[model samples]
Target chain A: MTAGGHTLQLFEQRFGALRRARRTESIMLFVILVLLFAVSAVWTDFSPTQILAGLPRIGEYFEKLFSIQPGRDTPPVAVLSWAHVLGGIKEPQSIAYWFYRLDVYAALLWQTVQMAILATVLGYSTAFALSFSAARTLTANRTVVFLTRRLLEVLRTIPQVVLAFIFVWPFGIGPLAGILAIAIHTTGALGKLFSELNENADLRPVEGIKSAGGSWLAQMRYGVVPQMLPGFLSYGLLRFEINVRSSTIIGFVGAGGVGQELKRVIGFNIYEEVSAICILILLIVIAIDLLSARLRHRLIGAL
Target chain B: MSASVTRHLPKIPLERRTLHWGIGAGAFAYFVYLLWLFDFDRIFTGLPKLWVIVRLMIDWTLFAEWDHAELIHSMAETVAMAFLGTFLATVLALPLGFMGARNIVPSPVFRFMTRRLFDGCRGLDQFIWALVFVRAVGLGPIAGILAIMVAETGILAKLFAEAIENIDTKQVDGIRSTGAGRLAELRFGVVPQILPVMISQALYSIESNSREATILGLVGAGGIGLRLSERIQINAWDQVAYVIVLILITVAAIDSLSKWLRLRLIGGPAARG
Candidate 1:
């Protein structure tokens, strides 16, 4: 009992000291966080005073994102006025009012979505063709894999907009430029991901196919492709979503999409229309994300 | 031979198989139509221009006469903008994340509202926010920083909320049993579980925001993109190539550095090795 009491006392003493030390560490961490914030605030010119002064202006800017109801007395930010918030298309408060040029915006939206889809399609096919050669377990030549990987790395690092700029010179300011640029970027991005997926794939089937005297093509078709298809498709879908956003922004550079329209209006100081298009984009993007996420979960979960 | 054929055959239902093929064919047909609509005639005629661009990019003489110091300044600004933006966003998101987290707030309505707010912020493209900030904050890297901050706050809040919601209830129960108040409970029970995830996500945002800040600069929000855009506006292909080279190097370097740091933060292979 005496020995037990002695050990318990020692344990208490050690833990008490440790706890104090941990408290000190947390205090230090907090202080360091504060210091980092202070330094970054200075470096980035993030003035709290300016931000506070700018708040009303910022709010005014966002307020412009909304259209006033034809005769509503309440502020746009007022609570629970669903009618004003969701006013009918003809109503000034409605989304349609801000997005008055629905047909034009819709066409641009479709063009942008198509750009993304086509780019992803092109990118995924190329990535699929190259991934087998890139994967270490499947590749016969190490040098080929290394070269392919490096090429993919270089491909992905350059901004897609820059690529769009390059291609615009060739393709002359259309969806073609946007499509080709995004496709080049997707190739690099998707190709890297594809190879990584391929590397992690089960090799048992590949070995089995080889032992059965299967051709190289047959081995990949029967073995690796089946195992990696779900992941590849999921990645492709994610890339498509990203490419849609990229296509929209690339249009700001005169590549193609509703983004060009956005730039046009913004250039003219048509803030309401810009927000309208931005809202439309937000709605579309969210819907696509939620839908794709559902599909992705179901598909990947089944695996 | 018949038995082997039966075993080798795919087991997909006939309707599903037909549906799949039909969808594929329809998609392909539409894609072709879209491509045809896009005027591919320029591709053939513009081959010379493409060659010209290739030659321009290869000409190393562009860098010989340009202002190297200004280029370096812009590059530094880009990195700083990313770091500051990500930091500020994460700071804002900490409380917002708690408010939005179902497990933390325990009120579905409040959590739902907070999450919806975040969604609105995230749903808009990054450039759109940059455009808005350029208007609000005036044209500069400050606008770019704010844009990054606001956009990333939306993203980080959702991620942090999810991380918080995923924490083991048993852990929190231990702290609550001690009669600890809300802040204490959070410090003791909540923060530890999600700290690593938050750090990792913030670090990742830093890398992503660097890419984004470059583009934001194009809209006059300020960064190396400003330089690139100015050059592009003038059709200065050689200077454009020089900017591209700098961007590529910076991106590659940051990627490797961040990868190393991320692994270390997570105590992964780099940390062990």
Candidate 2:
């Protein structure tokens, strides 16, 4: 009975120590909350009543989308004729016809996915080779590292969206422009990530290779590649997910993807078709995410 | 005998696979030749046109008629959309993050489900969601807000959950041994440790989303992007320049503000370092 009581007292003492350490964190959290509230109050015109009032309008829009059809006055689209083959000739005449043209959206989605994959493969492969040279343990050449790192920074600083806009002018309206833009951005990002992974590699094996009088490439191939593959894969997969999403937006500027379809549908106020395309995009993204996470988990465990 | 054998260890030929260098040189020359064939000198001649546009842009920014107060009003609406979207996403991330965290969830099934939910949200771009919501919400700022919220929340939740999972378990274990409830353990033990990193990252996301808000508005979600797009259509290069400048300034301002707030909120080098 006495020993149990002593253990309880010891537990209380440890709890006291934990509480003391946490006090500062709690205070900081409170301050963050207060600042958030203060900023919101000053910057926004957020009235609870306005949010309440807007709810019915939101429901009305959804209802109209679900019940989309041609009325008596509305012209029914008999067929989607193709005089231009390359462009929409008659524009969508009815909401129902727009929904029927899901093929266009699907084709664009495929283009976006293709661009993302091509860019990720190209960018990650290039970065994988260069990262060996950039790693401090692998090479002591400050000049080489500096130039490579600086090059990466400049590349990454220019967002893919901005690059897409620039490419549109020079390359004209096509997926090629989007692919190039995303590839450039991915190269820089993957390079930085790869170098960091290199820096964190188990140096013992690398040192063993060096002591054996191995060439630089020998050390990299035999020692570095094995350690860094998991990290490289994880980063590349993450970039692929990011690229898929960005590819959609790049399409808006005539880069050729589902984004263009989305824009046209919104402009014409084709509500039902808009919902369908959105649902399609969401599903694809969700699938990519689930697949990537599972792959990452398996890789991390193996490592 | 060993010394003599060691001396005979021939030098390994310098692994100079010159083919790679040769290929690189060839590619560079080919690129230059391609550019030359395309009349790359046109870029220099076009500099003046670019300058003219810049000058017109400056004029619009400083001297254009305020008659279109709608433009300014729309700008505010865009900002409001971003703020609301970011706020909603952050709120959603809290529980989603915990559920997705492997350490917190413990059960593989629950973790798997929540993690997939995070990915699904983040996998699609906000612009796609904007198109969808504009249909359902009927072409307004509300649509923009919803799109940004759903997309950003998914991304933020994944990041937050990862951070949570990577945290030291010792602190949590200590709390659990004290007979604390799960919520209490999280409140006192886990939140404190990761809060600073979370805040700093969240601020960066806010900055990024603000820049993105302009593009989201282009899809009729109601923001400065609509004005920018209209100007581009009407050959109003000057106004386009003006709007670009406005966006640049806003993004730059937010960038600095995030840096400052992150420093203060975290209250140490841990904010960045």
Candidate 3:
């Protein structure tokens, strides 16, 4: 029998071919990687000694949590009483010292969720409309398609946080600014998604509709939208998950979410409670991501 | 068929006309109300003075008296931080992404768990991660880099997994039928196809993280943003403008370079589309 007939031999050969990295290329890759590491080390102020030294500060910060004191007498000001502080409330000073203000966090979370939902829905629908024109097969207006695509790119190029700050001046420090920020981003993102979907859509139905004398809107309605809906819904679901996390950050600029609270905690050096909030946010994000994934899968499967 | 039978065909419901009119109307109303509240007069009144602010901004960033050298150093630090963070995230994400991919693993349970783990890693904002790292490691660019790396890993991993899953399975299958092991199949069949996408994504992530790294510095992570916040607190609108301009130019340059590189790597239409 030929040597190639052995299964183990074939596997070894395949693996060998895949693993055959040229010495020069491998060296270059290693050099680049090392350089990146070196740059990170240089830019960061973290030294081993500093981390060790900061441990006491972290301890002292925790110690001050159980008692109220002036900034100089201890570390930072201690805001929390003993009970809640002992119960592992991170940043007891930020939460309890301000008058049992978990309510604010709850309220902000609600606002963030509301804004995310509203914006995602709005953005997805607008994308659905604009994508028809943008798709090469769906529309003949080259100028309109090019302009709209460019508009979306410009919109997306501006960071969402920057957009939030810009809108804050106009819309005031409320969920309105945050919602607008997210909506605009969603429009850009979803528009791109929808256009791609439209471009890849089966052409037979569109041709049939056109040949049968359907108008532009009619052709879209009868042929394109149906085919594009599944992809659009999937993209929208994904965006919704992202918006929830981003909405919190937008809160830092007075858009009203958990991020505002986060800023306050950090400014006051409320470390433990900061940890708590981080944990909470992480849980929420994970839950939403999982849920969105499942929902998207089910949605597409149903279609 | 008989004429009577043809005439008696059942009537179907007209295609349901449930357009999203309510959402459209609500959004339009909100836009109008917001526009009115912004008070255009206030903005217009401030516009002419913007030139003076812009001048001040330039001086603060490029020609500041107190710490001109320091500001330049900080700007470099910010770029370095973004580069490190994005590179680390990309490297860490690639393996996890392969595991998380549906088509790659073919084990539903394993994929689900890995996917959730990725979500957990990426779910928190980089700022929050920065806060966490600062406390753990103390405030510095290290904290910033670590924060961005952990935060971005989740997103990059998800995107990478999606790219992998979307790849044509036939090539991988062909490699396997040649008695190739899974790793071999991935290296030869999967890696080549997705490498360009991964590179483009890595560049985009670097661009995005640069913006984010600036914000992380606001909380004392380290970068130009730390100085920017300082100026803002002192109501240095001109300085703020200067810093903004610096950031803008840097970001624009990176964006253009990334686009050019992407086009070069992939044929133009394919790269862009």
- Enumerate the chain B TM-scores of all models: 0.91, 0.80, 0.77
How do the residues B100-195 of candidate 2 rate in per-residue lDDT, one tens digit apiece?
A: 888877899888888777766776687777766665555667677778889888988998898998888898899999999989899988988888
lDDT of 3 by residue, A11-70 (tens): 988877755644445577679868866866667653557657766866765665455555
Relative to the true structure, candidate 1 has a C-alpha RMSD (angstroms) of 4.1
TM-score of each: 0.89, 0.63, 0.66
> DockQ of each model against the real complex?
0.57, 0.18, 0.27
lDDT of 2 by residue, A1-303 (tens): 999999999999998987765776668777976676555434444445644665686666565543424677774423333532223424343333444666777777876787777767767778887787777767899989888887776666455665565455546666766777788888888898999899999878878989989888888888888988888889999999888877777877776678777777767866666666777777777677778889888988888
lDDT of 2 at B233: 58
Per-residue lDDT tens digits for candidate 1, residues A1-303, read 999999999999999997787677668767976886776667657777766765687777656555453346855542225776577776664555676788899999988888888888888898888888888988989999999988887778778887786788767987888888888889999998999999998989989989989999989999999999899989988988888778878897778987889888877867668777888898888877878888899989887
Assess the local accuracy of residue B165 in candidate 1 as a C-alpha lDDT between 0 and 100: 88
Clashing residue pairs in candidate 3 are A90-A272, A90-A273, A91-A272, A91-A273, B56-B238, B57-B238, B57-B242
Model 2 docking category: incorrect
Query: Candidate 3's residue-wise lDDT over B98-155, tens digit each?
Result: 9999887899999999997887777778977787677767667877888888989998
TM, chain A, every candidate = 0.84, 0.74, 0.77
Off by over 4 Å in 2: A1-54, A68-70, A73-103, A129-144, A201-223, A293-303, B1-84, B95-120, B132-146, B156-204, B207-214, B220-273
Model 1: how far residue B68 lies from native, Å? 1.3
Write down the worst ten-residue block by lDDT for model 3 chain B.
B11-20
